[model samples]
Target: GYLGCQDTYYVGNFKGIGKVYSQVFIDSYTRVADAKLYTDKTALTAADMLNDRVLPWYETQGIPILRILTDRGSEYKGNIEHHAFELFLSIEGIEHTTTKAYSPQTNGMCERFNKTMKQEFFDTAMRKKIYTDLDDLQLDLDIWLEHFNNERPHSGKYCYGKTPMQTFKDSKKLAVEKNNEILYLDYISDSQNLTDNQVQNL
Candidate 1:
């Protein structure tokens, strides 16, 4: 099951780029993460993060994002009919849960990730080069994320010192088995209901 957390971070002002933001997503179990740079923070941008990166990756892996945890920020919380983020989640059949007020631990995975990115990526990158455009910053970020997910060994409670990708691949079989078990149980239940209806017709 894909339990995930999402948060937006202020990536600071760049020379010609002005202020940039980052929409970030992290898998709670495996700590695998993805981020995209945006010029502004909005409901549409929030939804785009999942549309452009998170969901597609999960689709390739043959798993579904079961639920997502987010903060009470305007970009994340609103009416399903009017808000882009809410509507996107509704259309995708993914559950959305919000963190409790003043409870930072509720979204700790994403919070910790933001810190890591600041220290390891943004801090270093800013010192090394001047970014003139969102696309340029995004390109370098993507390269760093590739290393973060595939090369760095995560000490997350569930990762056991393996890279996020390694942990995800190692545990994917169990996730598939559990999903199959759920489907088999549902099939049995439906068959029983159908048999009861046939007997009632007699």
Candidate 2:
């Protein structure tokens, strides 16, 4: 349940929107990634990215985020009691670790993914379509991200040639064993019991 996190600013403005930023999170094990665009780079936006996307997606997959690694940027580093991002992580019981100073390689997975995203998605999409608003751009980004996680085979250390989603699914049993927890078995059992009861009543 470890993830690498980073934020990147768009090199240029959109047609009418002034400036935008991208908050990205990638599973260090499976290389599954999520990103969202925001108008400004702030602790609130950083928290929002996790609150709105990252955590929910992981929860749906029955995976818990135990820790996250990020750089010592202002948006990510701050007082745990006061900063939005820090408070959010604290509330979610996630450990936050920062990269070693001046050592970008400590978080190289996120760095490489950012570069790949720019090259494979942004550069090509910008050439083909003119985005005037962040929502439209976000929609296209979501589609691209879906393809990235579910369709594209990854060469991650553990992934070999499997797609990120496949790798994530195949590794869930190991994650559960490592954490010494059942992967939502109680909830699934409850649902199954309810279905059996309904069948009996019918």
Say which candidate scores most in TM-score.
Answer: 1
Go through the candidates in order and give the C-alpha RMSD of each one to the true structure.
2.0, 8.7
Best of the candidates, lDDT? 1
Superposed model 1: Cα runs more than 4 Å off: 187-202
lDDT (Cα, tens digit) per residue for candidate 2, span 1-202: 4554655545457777778789999998889888899888889999999999888877786668889888888889999888999999999989899998888688888888888888889999989998888899899999999999999999989899999889989998787676554446667888999999999999
TM-score, candidate 2, is 0.85
| Model 2 local distance difference test score | 0.85
Across 137-180, the per-residue lDDT of candidate 1 in tens digits comes to 89999999999999999999999999999999998998878767
Off by over 4 Å in 2: 9-11, 181-202
